[model samples]
Target: MEYKYKLAKLQYDKEKNEELIKRQRKRAGQVFPKQLEVEFWQQHLEQARHNINQYFWSGVLIYFIITVLMITGDYWIIDRNFFKHDFIHSLLGLVNGAFCLLTLFFFAHYKILRPYYAYAAMAMIFWAIVSMTWLTMTVHTEVFRHQAMMIISMIYIMGFVLTGVKPFHMLLTGLMAAVVAMIMLLTLYIPIDVMVMGRVLVGSTVVGFLISKMLCTRERMIFLVMHQARLSEKINRIHAEELLHLSQHDALTKVSNRRTFDEMLDSYFEQARHDEVPLSLLFIDVDFFKKYNDHYGHQKGDEVISAIAKSIKDSIRHMDFVARYGGEEFVVLLPETDAHGAYAVASNIFKAVERLAIPHSQSLVDSNVTISLGFTVYKGEADIFKSDFLQRADQALYRAKQLGRNQIYYHTLQVEEVL
Candidate 1:
């Protein structure tokens, strides 16, 4: 009976394990689909933001130019007799100028109403056409006044079309078409003949279309050039950053390379000398690395070196500098560190490497991988030149290797000036 019970328990556990595995597989499938949905929405939002910013600024600049032109032309060019005491005509010009300036101010600040700003601009343009038409009707027999009003109306309509004003674009186009037709019908009332009105209407239509096309083309070209310039500036910045990284980093371990280390050492040494402070240096070498490379293949050897480099970097202070000093060797620069402080830091590095427990069967020192470190501390009136300081650290490293390897040695320079 006990054996029978055990067999039933085993069957129940097997069924439960299979169910858990099936649920895990279903979850994995669901995760990928949800990630794709999130990514699509993120991209769409970014594109919408870019388009809104572009159109917002472009609309602001266009409105400012138009407002300035209208104010200047109204003040200087148009004759009051053409409007003929029509207060509504003068009021329309003022309204058009004010609305354009207001639209410019709102876009320069709010920016969220970019799409609707175009519609506001189109409304101002409509008022402009109405004002011009009233002026034209008041002086229908005066050829110059009649022609100027028609030209202004046609130019305003072209502005509507170029800005993609949609319903207003169609409305303005229809209004211009109707005005041209009426001018044809009313030529009998004018002093000018039918042929002259026909010529004026045709000329106005051709010129309006041409001006609109030219403005659209010029705006598109300007946008393209500006976009390219921004892209080039971004690319150049990234390239400069990459070049800086290459100059300062080791190719293999991705730590500071020898050249950067030397440069930094010189700079810190100067600062320490000026501030009357101490600076320390540690030179580290991997023990029996060549034998380890011979035992394992070169590829595994590279992995070991990379792992050791990471260990050394992890062991150092964040403010200290560590760099690859050549094959299976490294250097550390500790600013404001004395001999005792540097020794403690080097001992920590030695222990951290041992904790990695990488196999080194042919190692001359131990069964596990280990490193030897030599440190030198520089204080006021040290017995060494800058070059001698480096040499002393190298000498200590050699002595540590000679004395059995996998140990830390400390050296202090005593400088005596020869009289």
Candidate 2:
């Protein structure tokens, strides 16, 4: 089971990678053909930047201490007359200049936030060490030649530890530095054991590469965790929105439920009143719906209601609002519509239901299922209460049912008849 689960997870990850590649292709339009590679480097750059910003000053302080110690150790322990050499001043100047340059860049990094600074700073230090290696190889004293190799090894370890160079760049810089040191020692004909020197150089380079690889893996894992968290957050937000939508809509009819209707009515009425526009309401009821439900089953009754709701939606304008007010009843709100527009909409809804031709053997009004509609248009103002508007529309609906159903009754100044 565990093996199968692991295989499934691997497949899921592969699919995600493909999707990411497709999206990148579409968005970039051929710029990033190798999406995963580009994405990995981009993420590495960001992570490196973050790591530098967090620990850069501290790392610089440690580097300064280590460099000072190395120079002092060489002068005191390895070569008592180190400063007497003709090239000593140049060697110290080069190393000091590189250190100062890297320190200045660290201060500027806050505003710059560029990855190239890291590369450039490391390059400066790298060359300084190379120059020192040459000076040490050419020194008159033969006994201190191995000391130069030891110092070079210290430089490698210190650069990796204190500079926080990104892993890929670190590996490249370390390998190049090691290779150059070996070549320089050989070219200068320094009296040293070739076997020992090669062992030290190759061993240090291998260790540095391993350490850099580990750091890269750590950064990649961090980036993946952050990316997954962001995706999960987005997914959760989408689910929350869907739940909210489902709560406001009828599961059966797929129309706004009573809760949504009440909320929307308040909002629309307020807007219409502020804008000084007219608002209309249509209160609709299915004719003899209880009898139809009893004759057929409640399941068929549900189908009929859903069909009528759809017909009402099809007949209305986009701006109009429809809601399942209760069983066998629906309400519509038309903003900025006058009594004539409401009447026209009601007549169309009547026709839409009739066109459905759903046989209702138990319906008292007609052989087919039908509806009665009543509507009222109000000149949006503060003078009239919302309940009064609803009551007037309800009275018109009652009048339509009394006038023998399947008809429209509209109330404005007084009761008005609509076919």
Candidate 3:
């Protein structure tokens, strides 16, 4: 039942992820259901940060080279008529470029940068617009001013794309840059055609917005598909593990079943026949279990069995194996154990079940529920058959029953001990 519940939950999650992926395949899928959209971004943060590092760090080297070229151009004048070099405007451009590099480096190295990426993107757009606008005003030639404005337009678009923020954030940052640019133009009173400036800004904003939407759609699809594949693999692994457990474990007692015990016994018998190590088997049966069930009810009998199984498990070492051999009977296989070790383990198991103190008035052995244990250890002997070794343990169990129940009997080929 526990395994069933877990398998069901995994299936549901897998279906849900696939559904989300399908929804995203449509045109309007960019806008996800509110809470899920938030979760998506949170999960994508590591990838987002990595994309930022690649773009912004690369921008750092580009900007540094631009700064160097700007400084050199202060002395060299190839076109005096088309380009008027104003030191103030050049200084402003150089500062913006250097500041962009340093800011990206600081965010990349210093702190948790994912949360602040949108803000950093907006800052990149705003500063680039300010410096370029001032430089445009300082230029007297239309060629120089037009070129500077085109660069500013690229900056506005590249800010969001390179940052890899959500489409909503991209639009918001673009609109904010346009609004702030108008404010700067009005206050600075830079002499230029306002109509041309408006056209450039609007065109750049529209182009950037469309590109961001397209890129975001592709990214969202890839993320969903990758995660869905992982979810499917997880579901397969979990289902296989649960099925294997069911095939090998007893349903009622949650211990290894009779089939598992039989397979293990055969393997160990073979090992003992050829190897130097000894193989020990302990046969366990509840005392007066039939009478106990008749008096206390079958439910009570089941509870007793489960409790006794647990107690037996806790009493033995991790290397030992315990299984429900049949109704009200169990078997423990101890590998590499000598006579003394097998005897001690059988003794502990008998005492531990007795300590459970489950009420069993039908049990003639004791007022509370108790158990009988019979164990035998077989040292490697080429002369003896594996069937003979198992028969020895069964014979000990019959001997314990004959002497009266609720006790332990240890028997070997040449010796017998009672405890």
Instruction: List TM-scores for all candidates, in order.
Output: 0.62, 0.65, 0.74
Could you tally the backbone clashes for each prediction?
2, 0, 0
- Between prediction 1 and prediction 2, the one with superior TM-score is 2
lDDT of 1 by residue, 250-367 (tens): 8779899999998998988877777778899999999999999999878888888898889988888899999998999999999999887898889889999999999999997899
Predicted candidate 2 versus true structure: per-residue lDDT over 1-419, tens digit per residue: 44455556655655574565455445532232366457766765555556666766786787678667766665654444554783474356446645744663564366564646566646854775576666655665555575667766666665565455655576677678767877887887766677887766666656766675666555545545555565555556656766797899998998999999999999988888899898999999999999999999899999999999999999999989999999999999999998888888998999999999999888777899989998887787678878888888898899899999999998773444343
True-vs-predicted CA distance for residue 175, candidate 1, Å: 6.2
Q: Tell me the tens digit of each residue's lDDT in model 3 across 106-161.
A: 56545776457556756766667666766665665555566677777877677657
Q: Which segments of candidate 1 are over 4 A away from where they belong?
A: 1-84, 91-119, 131-148, 154-210, 218-244, 380-384, 414-419
Taking all chains together, the TM-score of candidate 2 against the true structure is: 0.65
What lDDT does each candidate get?
A: 0.65, 0.73, 0.77
**Model 2 error, position 74 (Å):** 11
- Best-performing candidate as measured by TM-score: 3
Number of the predicted model whose lDDT against the real structure is largest: 3
Please report the TM-score between candidate 3 and the true structure: 0.74
User: In model 3, which regions exceed 4 Å deviation?
Assistant: 14-22, 25-27, 54-84, 87-95, 109-115, 258-281, 287-304, 314-321, 333-348, 355-369, 376-399, 411-419
Q: Which RMSD values do the candidates have, in order? A: 15.6, 8.5, 5.0
